[model samples]
Target: VTKPYRLRELIARIRAVLRRSGSEPANDVIMSIGEFRIDTIRRSVVRDGVELELSRKEFDLLALFASRLGQVVTRDECLDEIWWGRDLADTRTLDTHVKRLRQKLEADPSNPIHLLTIRGVGFRLDP
Candidate 1:
């Protein structure tokens, strides 16, 4: 396992390693939603035929949404997955990352179509 990675990442690595023989790891294991194609194993995101530069945290954040399109993922769920159980009760880290994702992916960040806020709940990705 790589240094400074979560259990989820280690599991993904193991899954990638488990693909053998005729399978190509790099071409396989991609999660997509709308124009966004998230290569979980490679930790990359490409939207509408163009690859958008994303920070590690931003990639992780998008990967989460890409996996569950059109679903309302709670704020706590995002926090636990990205922050890995840190005490971020009052932090705006997730919000900032989401905003960045919108700016990069959405045509209008103010009124996003892909990444959406769920009022007092969390967020949703409408693919």
Candidate 2:
């Protein structure tokens, strides 16, 4: 039982939140590394001018790594942030997501250029 104006206002607020959350205010939310570009707002990744499909987890994982942009993000950190503390006692979920992210973002998944593993520590994104 909401008024028309109230409904309109609610919609406006929702749209604003969506816009703010999906895009970075300073940049275009389109992070580029070499030939790879990740659009945070669109949740899309493009490599060599070709678009690649990614799952929700893949997109979130990439976004987290891109946001760090050179800092190491530990598996526990990722689980806490991305999974929102949802009982990820096992690190395999993080590994799987990282693997998927690497396959999509890296030119060579075996010798990744963007996503680097820190071994016994965590993962880092190399600009």
Candidate 3:
């Protein structure tokens, strides 16, 4: 019983530390692009003021794109940053995540308004 309590305390301390260091901004909790808004702290995305459901990977991908809006983010960069430098197991993983993100956030997934794929390079999030 005492051991479990001690473990819980340790876990709580680690969580607190991670939360302090994580991406949640101190002042601004929102990232907005046109009708889309992302709450970084809440890990939620809203389009036209309506909440959109997203998987963990999808949310991370969107957050990364939003953080680097208007900048080209390469596959390796994304894999390293979002996947925590872990091997993606397949290069297609990034593509898949991007596709999902586009489907959710883009006005037209085929033509894509916000998420733009740069042929032979990578992707850019238009601001």
lDDT of each: 0.77, 0.77, 0.78
Window of ten residues with lowest summed lDDT in model 3:
1-10
Give the runs in model 3 whose Cα sits over 4 Å from its true position: 1-25
Ranking by TM-score: 3, 2, 1
Per-residue lDDT tens digits of candidate 3, residues 86-118?
A: 555688988988898889887779988789998
Clashes of each: 0, 0, 0
> Would you list the clashing residue pairs of candidate 2?
none
Winner by TM-score: 3
Full-model lDDT, candidate 3: 0.78
Alpha-carbon TM-score of each model against the true structure: 0.74, 0.75, 0.76
Where is the poorest 10-residue window by lDDT in model 1? 13-22
Error of 3 at 50 (Å): 1.0
lDDT of 2 by residue, 13-125 (tens): 55545644774565757788667798977899888889989999888877877778889988766765666545656788889889988887777899987799999889998
Q: Candidate 2: deviation at residue 15, Å?
A: 22
